[model samples]
Target chain A: MAQGNFILREKEYLALQASLKKLLANSYAKVVFLVDKNGSLIASAGATGDFDTTSLASLTAGNIAATGGLASLIGEKEFSILFHEGERDNMHISVVANRIILVVIFDRRSSVGLVRLRVRRTATELERILRDIDAGAGKEEEGDFEELTEADIESLLK
Target chain B: MSFINYSSREINCKIVYYGPGLCGKTTNLQYIYRRTNPESRGKMISLTTDTERTLFFDFLPLSLGEVRGFKTRFHLYTVPGQVFYDASRRLILRGVDGVVFSADSQLTRMDANVESLENLQVNLREQGYDSDRIPLVMQYNKRDLPHVASVAELHALLNYRNVPEFEAVATTGVGVFETLKAIIKLILIDLKKGGR
Candidate 1:
């Protein structure tokens, strides 16, 4: 039917929500949330009900993509931080395991200083968690080139 | 004569629309097709299953105006989002210059979004394209639905790193162009920076 269809299992959602809640509690930011690389809403806490997380997710992914490209221009291997600040609200974006993006949205209710402080530690932990998932997925081993049957190729070509 | 003809004025880049199954990935392409001028777009091709779901891929070629005397053409593709179709997704992602991730907006689709996003990363890594370094854009589709999660909630769960994210309703073409423009602009700028 529809393309890019994603169905979130309850267990994963609970875990994501719990992790987000925990992350938010550690910071004074009035709003703390998360969105997928495709701009889908996963789990969030604080000021989340007010905005379109899906739209924000799309924008966040775009931001990371641009920054990552910028990183390469500088001869860097990867891009990490996409942090920005405004007069009233500040945003910080980081890449975690190259899979999911970790975003922190804070306002004057929480200083940019505090968001940055929490982001540093949270990003590391998020990376580790994603790494664990990767290890468990059994696709971690390199060079997984499956020989394609002619039928398979034909099917794709069609 | 060069076999590949890379020195030609026209530069072609591949952009893939990737995500989990039924996440409105195809809808994004369809909306783009409907809105684009017939002269500016090629015939839309879809390889689908017996049930008519896109079993393999969807392809659309678009001309994104001209730059520096060379026409910039983008071949947009969407991989089958089903979990079992990982191989196909990988194959499609190869040689891609940019990506637009079309995430489903429903609350229940959260895990699938995360899993598919991870899949994109793994596949990209396997192909020697670092996901973190590629020009990627995110689109949370189906924003017109009522059961969708709030943007704050989504940001907390999916956007811990705060990437360029967008809100879209693919069926109606809302925010689709914005998403495409953002990724294309990013890719073009990257090429310019690389002196390509």
Candidate 2:
């Protein structure tokens, strides 16, 4: 991938993590995994604890991709959320925009129903955020990268 | 007519095994990997975190028989069945073709199963897919374990809509192929009807 594409993807990744943190607020989740459209782990939140978010993010992307295909087969358009229940914990996976995914893990304390409901609303919000970011990127193309001084890159590094 | 033109007339479709954490979603994939012919499948890749939990995803691409001059391909994936990973799950669901809802058939897990199913519905809807219309198959996995709920009981709670459902013991490979074949069939049949 070109440096420009890499930078954009990285930016998209960071944005997704920030968005996930905001959505998971008050949810009491242990960890949050964010993946790209191709099922690559872009970012994660909460405790590293005992789980691996990178692998989980990739797998989650693969799962959703397959699920989306399945949805199309049945004459549907896309896939939104997938939930799995366990004795001690539960998993909630939701699709955000067309390029990112959100994975939430919670225990008995949190209600799966509540998470599911919250996820639906968050998906819509995340979509809007992504659209805004894309628009901003477009606007920046007009003398954007050319205008950035060495100071800007240095500040970003800081 | 050859619909997919990129590859060797091989129609590669993705299938996701989704369920709650530890509900045998991974088990289903493991069983398939163990039993499938090596020549027909690619190397199984599982990405994990520092502690070795599935972080990004698990991928296993399998080659099934040809259909209408297309070599049937199925890439199976399992989400990090943990709750906090919703973002990752959403990303993985892009361009999916079929799904296997691996439910833990334990009496104690009844509520979780219901909640998970509903979550599936909501997630599918967000991606513009109606849960009722997707090519979905249900697998009540972990039947070998004691204290697990019976098939009938699970059906009563999770199968209210009456989609294709199967009883599975993922650890022993029981119902694994049945579940896989069922979903694959659904995808192929769907393609034939939709003219995709």
Q: Sum up the clashes in candidate 2.
A: 63
Give per-residue CA lDDT, model 2, range B1-196, as digits (tens). Answer: 1113222333446677777877888777778889888887766777667875667567887777654444556778887777777766665555567778989888788777887778777777776665776679999987877898878888888887787999888888889888888887776655544422
CA lDDT of every candidate: 0.67, 0.68
Computed on C-alpha atoms, the DockQ of candidate 1 is 0.01
Q: How high is the lDDT of residue B153 in model 1?
A: 76
Predictions in order: chain A TM-score: 0.71, 0.72
Q: State the C-alpha RMSD over the true interface residues for candidate 2, after superposing those residues.
A: 19.1
TM-score evaluated only on chain B, model 2: 0.92
Per-residue accuracy of model 1 over B2-90 as CA lDDT, tens digit each: 00112233445668999889888888899889988888886677778998688767777776655544455677878899999776676
TM-score per candidate, chains pooled? 0.54, 0.56
**What CAPRI class is candidate 2?**
incorrect
